[model samples]
Target: MKFKTAFAAAAALTLATAANAQVGPEVGATVYGPEGNTVGTIEAMQDGVVVVNTGTYTAPVPANAFGEGPEGPIVSVTKDQLNAMMAEQEKQMIAARDAALIENATVLTADGVEIGTVTSIDGDNAIVTLEDGPVSLMRDQFATNETGALIVLATKDQLMAALNGGSVEGGEAMEADAE
Candidate 1:
């Protein structure tokens, strides 16, 4: 019957579409660092390693290097590793583009300090604003969730100085000016 044929055709199309859903590395996926900082974006995949270009560097890493982020999923990679891969001219352009194109990034310090969240990222650095508690920190220093607490990355002296209302030269004053 015509109805039966139409139904079968529709079903086949649906199945085919589902089967064609793209998987594996995709552009705009979040790339992470070993310490959990969003290092860069996925430029490409080669030889089982995901090539991440973090603007400053491009490196090939294991498939597990990436995870999810607010803008998208974050993958993991490192600067040194990326540099080594740069020897091959084929991957240079994409890697650099991927590195430079990253707009959002999870930021942190080298020692795993839970600094305030990064508002944005650019080549070689990011703009981080002070956030207020135990800010969740990834091992790589990018990507964190404050949840219910105010995220902070100040040292004991710094916090005491802040609470006590002190000023550092050049930096903005901590407390609001009295009315």
Candidate 2:
């Protein structure tokens, strides 16, 4: 029993140490533009991409696009260049979403269970009206099925929770009917 306990404790410590070593860019770190001008601060990292929030706009720069300067992380593009790139990306995304006809598209789970239809799209979120209520699904949480329908990467129970005012990860309850 003593040997087993010691092994378990050592394993736990090793796992914790490994986890702490996977550090990324720190939040609140200063970000510099290509022209070496201060543009924004790091907000967060999402899927290996660094999100920087400038005073006017938030941009996502790929991890590879950043370099360690004397001060901190710096991008190889000026603020105007970053804005232009973001605008182009947004345009392409909007075009793709429009092509998918996400608005009013049937929403289904991975198991082919139908939950609701997308009523509208607002920014990066799609407003879905389930039988119970309305919920907001982020665009990234959905994919285009082979039949051109919108498939939510979640379970029916998860979708229902968002509709019923229960918190769903990466989703929001837009409006719940009072009963």
Candidate 3:
């Protein structure tokens, strides 16, 4: 009984150690850009982007700024090498976005202005049905593109209001869309 207990404990320890050994990108990992420049040391990864310590250049590059490395002394990487690393990261992002699961979401302008909810997206052609009726401030229009993901960024209520030619006011609605 003593031997069996001891064996179980040992087995558990081994399994725990193995699980802990799985490797992931570490804080302070070297980051490179598209042109192989040493961008900085990774500080954090959040919201699908990489934050790095500022050295010669600004940090917090999108996760698309890193790549597999020869794992070495962290601080010695040069600017060009870092750029190369980031280039690799960007390629991966493009590939992943291309293969992203097709689902309905809201669309925003490049400047993050709320546009409309995606009615349907077929390949690069996204049908963004207008949310509000034409607003004087913002144009109600559809966008179509190739090799880009259509992002939806609004709620059904917002869409309905917009379609009815209503405007969002200071924490209230100026005009209500017809029900």
Top-TM-score candidate index: 2
**Top candidate, metric lDDT:** 2
Which run of 10 residues does model 2 get worst, by summed lDDT?
170-179
Residue 81 Cα positional deviation in candidate 2, in Å, after optimal superposition:
1.8
Off by over 4 Å in 1: 1-24, 28-37, 75-179
> Relative to the unseen true structure, what is the C-alpha lDDT of residue 80 in candidate 1, on a scale of 0 to 100?
52
Residue-by-residue lDDT tens digits, candidate 3, 47-152: 8666666554344455543455455212334666555666676567556544432335555543345565544445554445455332221111222224354432
Ranking by TM-score, best first?
2, 3, 1
RMSD for each of the candidates: 16.4, 11.4, 11.5
Error of 2 at 13 (Å): 33
- CA deviation > 4 Å runs, candidate 3: 1-75, 101-103, 106-115, 121-124, 133-179
Per-residue error for 28 in candidate 1, Å, reads 4.4
**lDDT per residue (tens digit) for residues 1-179 in model 2:** 99999999999999988865554457899888777898688989878798888766798778777776777778878777777777897677655655664677877886689888888887776787777767776777676566666677666876567555686566544233322
* Candidate 1 per-residue lDDT over residues 51-169, each given as its tens digit: 77778666666775554444555544454555555655435543443343233343333234544444544453344444542222221222223332222234434533654577433
